[model samples]
Target: MKQAAQAREVDVLVVGAGVAGLSAATAAAWSGKSVVLIEKSDTIGGTAAIANGSIWIPNNDPAIANGFTCDLESQVRFILSECWDGFDESQKWCGVSKETFLRVDRYVKSGLRVARDLTNTRVQTFTQLDKIFKRYFFSTKDSVDSVRQALGPNHSRSDDELAKAACSSWDYHWENKFNKVPYGKHIWAAFDLRLAGKFFFSGFRKHLWHIVQNMVSIRSLSSLADQIPNLFTKFWGFGSGLILVERFRKHLDRQKVPILKRHELVAVATNGDRVTSVDVQTADRQTLTWKIRDALIIASGCFSHQLTGDGVQDSYSVKSSCVAPGNDGDAIRILKNADVQVNQNPRPVLAQTVIQLAKEKNAISHEPVFYFYGDSFFLVDRHGRRVMNEKLTYHDRAQHHVGNAEQEFLFLVCDRRFKERYWGLGIAVPFDQKHMIVGNNESTLHEEIDRELRDNDCDFRLADNFSANLRETKIAFNEFARTGDDREFGRGKNAFDVLGYMKPDRDHDAPSRSMQPLAGEELYACIYGLSTFGTHGGLVCDEDSRVLNSAGDPWNNLYAVGTCAASFLNGHYPSHGMSIGTGMVFGYLAGLHATSNTKRL
Candidate 1:
């Protein structure tokens, strides 16, 4: 039987405890409002906790400190260039609509403010990423020198090639016509290495002392350590999304904000044009209601959880999302219930190409296949056609899989040299030999694939003409490699295509580091599929972060931020940390506006 709903009153109610929700609650609490933050899951940090803890803020303080000035106009232009869809400037198209210009303008202007607020308030501290290659991973002395030698000004290369590569390495959309700004916007949550080292040593000593004091507990050390929740190695990691959330969580706790975890937003009750209250369901199945005195901000994330059958797969043709399990479109349902209009972007799912593998007997795993180690490898369709530029951003590369509905899977074909180089790249999870399809030569490779298909014993299925098409494809690839020109997909034309991952060796002599002829005798193929970050489209929101109704009117006490609202950039992903950064920007705006003294409707 359903329990009667217990009622409570609050000045501001923030849903979902992800970066955006936490940001909103923090802003509201700082504004002296009585705010209550809730999370559907037991854990407070959502997908943001598992992410790389970076935020892309234009004209951020760190960048300014580094003497890289990114003006507001340039920020808008850069975003528009990234979202360009062949529309004229007067149409104000950043891919969504004419109003996208306004949204982008607001995002660019307010993003820096949000960053400063978070920093000044000690909610989160950020470090500007200055080096081009450092944007992806933690920079080491060896790596810095390697990249500098490979693409440094003193290197022997034509002006045009050098210039293009430099631009590509730093900016993903540098090739776009509208992008004219210098790159220096991305920043990551600052982590103190010295402090982390101290914590690590302390935790290590505590564990060792405990084991030594209790001689009989030596055999059970591993089990006891497991109960302690990663005390030994947790502080040692450099980049972690949990660090970002932890900072916000600590700030909120200090501000006396009530963070109710294991409490799911059930429904939103609204008056003619304003949200009145929200129903919530506790983990223990107790129903509760919160009457909104000021406003309710819905920052609940995407509808990507698989088992919930939230219709995201059917709606966006997406599979295997890496977001949190609780992001099951709770925000969308509540908004729809309140008669708010939710919109969809043409490309709603932000995804990456992933290889699905069977880790154990019955366990399935999806591993990202973003970088191909050397020029020997290329992604191909069922008929052995080159899938894409391969160097394109992961989000752009995933789009190729859905182009042909009949083409259910893509294959990564590489020689032995490529495989060895890839394995040496120091991936966190070692590639399992069971997922590989091997062949001594092209003919044997074809024969092996044919055998697998006939026996229905493989994860990937190729077309019958794969063998014939592969021969032609190999010749074409070799020709492109020899001439240092990928006329078909233009793979090596971009700087990021070369310097984004591992830095080129100083003694490397290939015409293009991103491309080299396939010389190794043995060949291998791995299956690839689509894996999403999260859904990008949701409730339509204005510049102030107010959720809008079908009539294009704002609901006075309702706002949506993060993945719950249609993103400002529409469907375009402009570099790393964009999703999290924009979410925080809007969340800040929502918190500020929702708490302001406007006539209650």
Candidate 2:
């Protein structure tokens, strides 16, 4: 039997405790509204906690006030150049309204203010980018000199050659496997492989190391860098979702605002086109209807399998290892049922790629030869076949691959060099020689294999059929080692130059060069899947953070911020800290919008 419905009233009920939702709640509370922020999860922070905690604000933020002066117009032009397809028409003739622009501006400023207070450091958006670049890239000659000293004279040449070989191989492998595939149509399909390798090897790893070093060195500096600030301010809890939720909760607590967690919104009771009240399910399963006399704001997330059968019917499951599990998209489903239009674009804002490389060295010599399997543009197996499209939404990929590919099993066939460089030569093998093989020990590798299988809920298989796969992979690799003709995928072009330069076999005769350790004496063949940060793209909203229906009409009290909304920038251009920045800015806008509307009433 269903429980009787309860009743309550508040100025606002913000759903989802992600960074954006929390920001909205904080803004609304600060504006003196009775706010009730609800989260489906036991705690909040969302994907922001797992992230590096950088907010990419394009213009001059508080940190780099004197370091650099940015012309906003120039920066905007650069962005437009990259996103000409969408911006060319939309930006002309005042397509972006002044009201939306002002709202975005105000939101950004507010976020900066919040960041300044939390970190206790004068940091502007530009300064953050500068800090990141200086820490990671060779901005100064001294930094390059230090890298050279560590790597020795051959570092530049060696690294560049390895990159070149890898890039060439990647391109060749991708085209041979994917070009003729019907769905492989996007230009990015050709570039993704090179981009992924470059970002991981050159960008992400280097930047991460630099940031860690900066954190340690900040104390030594005489200035305010000594005070190591919280990695995430405003948001609280341990994970990404939790941190943002905590920050928002704290803000509301300070303002004496009420919050009800674990309360699920069941339905929207509407009068004509406006939402009059929302029916919610409490922890005890009792229904409670809350009246919204003035306004309503829907910050619910997108629909997932847990919320709708549509997701399950399409084989789309929630397989994110990183995102908050509670984001099943119930809120989105309810809103959609209530005649609220939703944007269901098949593309994801951010896509992830994973590659499996073999790390093994020659038996007689200690030289390493890392063998990377997978095309430059798309993640593929040894047979040179595109596994997924560069822009297929992650949901589509996850749903398609999960539980089907023996999720946990991976076989890494390697030579000796890989053992010496990455892993100390204490090799291990499993008792079942058919399924697991190591030239050395038997227990340790078995244990690792077992653990992986258990974690992914999968079974293990032998490498009996690996010979065919290896033959295909070896053909691609050997071709690059000889001719350097990457006709299949086109390696030494555009962004791929970064990867091309990392090859070990490339000629390093040039005086000015950067080298990567591509020719280390290691070769291994392994199977792995891409680890994702989180999903991007949800509700579509205007610059003012107002949720727009499919017909281009505002959904009276509906709003979205953060990952729940389509990103303003193109999907390919990944700028660090942008997601967090968007969450905070949009959250602030939604809050202000709700507050102002309430005031007028």
Candidate 3:
């Protein structure tokens, strides 16, 4: 006998409790509608909880209200530059004219208008946030100095090399926001959107502690003076998503909204391009059918790990993504089944830290997804050659790792001094050294080599397929110690990297702007494998986040947001938190749009 699905009804059904889904559900509830928010994971927040939680909303109202400069034209140009890859002017919108079609500029404008009106409270929190965040860039001493050297008082602002060389060290985009609809395509690198509210909403205390602890060395005196006053007026949570989640979740609760966690969305019941209901299998294996009375909003995340099947393997297999496992392609599958077109969009190279587990396992019990290892770190291939610019952006580094032949295993070499400071830098938040190789600093090189005689066949111990790597690593260590540079690989050249970051090293002249340890710090190396942050692929949707059919018409009331839908940048990573920002804005739009259907009836 086939068991029957227990039927229920809701004004709005939101799948996924990630930042996007929560934003959507919250928006709908705010519209005076009953909303249901669900997550496949046991807990809320999704990957956003573990993430650094930086949301990049350019030209945001908070930034504007605070007198922060914004270069919207530059941001839009950069966003659309990559989008023009497969674009055909003759069929720019495929019969949807530029005036009526969701042009990227207009699309952004609409989202900004909605964001300003939809979440005024969230916007207020970021005012203090921008003040705290602005200091983080100025604290780094070297890159700013480099910018002065590269761009003299007379040089043109359009120098690309100077921008790359500057390593995005300064807040240069604020130089003149009043400038014309900027012709610059790479200006996003210079702008700080100031919308990364998680740092303010939650990480403020930890950040203050971090700043206070490092005050004598690298912290900014002025930033501390400017920000301390604001702290007395506000209370914050642990991070960006949690505080908002607490707020949104509470609002939903008061509105009689039921949030079903441990419920996996299984199938969508559609009728003539409209979603009629959603079938979800609960943690108890009970199938519950949510009959949509008004509209269905799919805020499920990207097709990153979690669920597996035929289609997902294609994108995720090429490069693995790092996010909560709950982001299976449920929304992608549902919409595809309804005759919607899904693009398996290819993105530019994104860098991610490829860590090799000691147990040859997939996950670490306390993995630090956001923080990078320190100034002493550098990656080496099997041949013991350095990888290019070890400190480039995580996605940039990850892209290089994907293309590298020696990506299966690379040595993550660090000195004892750098190792000692790992926890402070958030290398692994709530740091745990459960699977580390600690070389002896007190003993001689020969004596230390003797201690590794009984080494296991772990990747770290025998990285080059040798019986043991003590001899190979010891030689490299000595060379790096004496030179204070990786001459073979030019390792510390990126301004974005901690190693390359210029500190006031009065001890050595250091021929270039990059930094390195004085040597003899003792080796603490680990083998790492290439990893990804997440994949950007899924069903196609229009400006309002409405699911579009093959003929380019909206699918009645079905909508897709977050990772479940393709990124607005066409899978390309535009800046630091573009993914989260776009998802939230679109999710906000979807919820508002879905609820408007009720008003029409």
Candidate 4:
């Protein structure tokens, strides 16, 4: 490891190379401040590199060609009125600066402009389905009762309960029945509800219901309904992040920002309420201390077992999904050790569930679904007896079934129908099952599975007898579609249970209607051991991106961003693009603030 004899000085030292860190470094360097960015991984992208890369800039964004007549106050009011019920009263009225609002607006405009330019030039495609969906389906009342009644009474909750929850004060008008509780709160609620002998009720139902309703609503938005698929592809399909990251990276490179990869922060040298220097370890085990004369920004990320190799550490643990493996809680610990005031209030609104299963050869032959950031993964038996909810944050999901010592194995049951519709059976494939030789390296699918099993302390078993399970799962799904009862697990058994609350509003009369048109007989199941997404919890910081001491004051020369910084979304993991947006916006704020402070000095 090489050591510098003379101390290096920088305007800012950004820890972590994820979205937040990159954003901060980019902004700071662009602002004419010398900056140093460090990352534990050799790669600079962090989890965002693998992310779907959608930033949820609601209401009017740059995507709209004709400028809207709406003002920021009006727009903010409209959004708050629609989504406010889920927020605390204080947060509901908390006004965002006009500058911040405009920045977001400009970002939206830039994003849309890039999309349009790319699309016109055939680099990419852009679609505005949300507008289209709103235009066609302007109905404000979101009711699943019709769907429930069509399914059957046994599969669903009483119309009265559904209406009560839907119409209650808790319902945010725009979000419909979706509650504002943080993700952590929701997961804890699920665990508590389950322990109390509750069935058919869980947060998973609410989340899925929200997605279904949103999808249906988005579909009804415009006359361009025919183009909806293309729009969705533009937003969620692979390589979506390429445009955004590429544009941003270019901008930073032009500004001469220094991005240091594969470096981890070990300690902070502080001078009473301010950070003076940061000690970092590189991939090669070399340690370097960089002195910051102006400010230090921390965007490390939340602490999690997978990310930090540390177990659950707080009440917020329930809501955290796994993040990148390199995300340790060092950022938070360092700040806390410096006596920064942090928000330790229990987040009780977040909820999580995971499912685990294996794909048959037909389902995934070309592209395998990569699990990143610990989103939910569900493994359902033929009867949809959820074998696992793999998407939830690690601790909460693991605790659900870890106690069952006899549960040595779980199943991921899939049929020919599932394979045919979602992904072509011939092209979709898991990385573990492919046989290929590339760059002088030869590998086989079976070897990959064996290695994975061995590393995770488990074994994989293929089942040939999936016919019975498929029939049972199909029958249950049919029942659910027709009656909304979820007879197998009582999907909507309780009003407060997160899952139960999301019971599909079915048409009770159509109890025998099949949800899927494909046959289940040809499906197969693969069993594998489970793993976590990463970890959550990091250094606590305010919206300005300044690292806060335990006393709640900003560490004068320190700031944090990205997963390393405490999240603004709290516990709820919104759509794919939400976090990236948060990282970008906050990072920008931190950079601007840090640079301004530097100028003052």
Model 3: per-residue lDDT, tens digit, 50-102?
55455565555554543333466455544555444644335655233342236
Q: How would you order the candidates by TM-score, starting with the best?
A: 1, 3, 2, 4
Candidate 1 per-residue lDDT over residues 1-601, each given as its tens digit? 0111223888899998999999888887766768888898899778776565567777788767755564677668777766656545554353445445667787888888788877877788887533433433322423333234444455454544333333322455544444443346777777766544543454356445443333332234443443244233222234346777888898888877888888988888888888788888998998888788889898889765542112344444444556777776787766665677787543455443333332221112223444453467777787878868876766777777664554545677886555443431112112443455788876778777656554544445667788778878887887887787899988766655655554432233456556766766678876655656666668887788888888887888888888888775556777767788888877877888887722211
Q: For every model shown, what is its TM-score relative to the native structure?
A: 0.80, 0.57, 0.72, 0.56
By lDDT, the best candidate is 1
Better of 1 and 2 by lDDT: 1
**Better structure of 2 and 3 per lDDT:** 3
- Stretches > 4 Å off in candidate 3: 1-7, 65-67, 82-107, 118-124, 128-137, 140-143, 146-238, 306-321, 345-361, 364-373, 424-430, 438-513, 597-601
User: Every model's Cα RMSD, please?
Assistant: 8.4, 13.6, 8.3, 14.2
Task: Give one digit per residue, the lDDT tens place, for model 4 in 33-132.
Answer: 5777766777766655544455543332332332212233433343333322443324523454332333333433333332333244332233333332
Is 1 or 4 the stronger prediction by TM-score?
A: 1
lDDT, model 4: 0.42
Model 3 accuracy (lDDT, Cα): 0.52
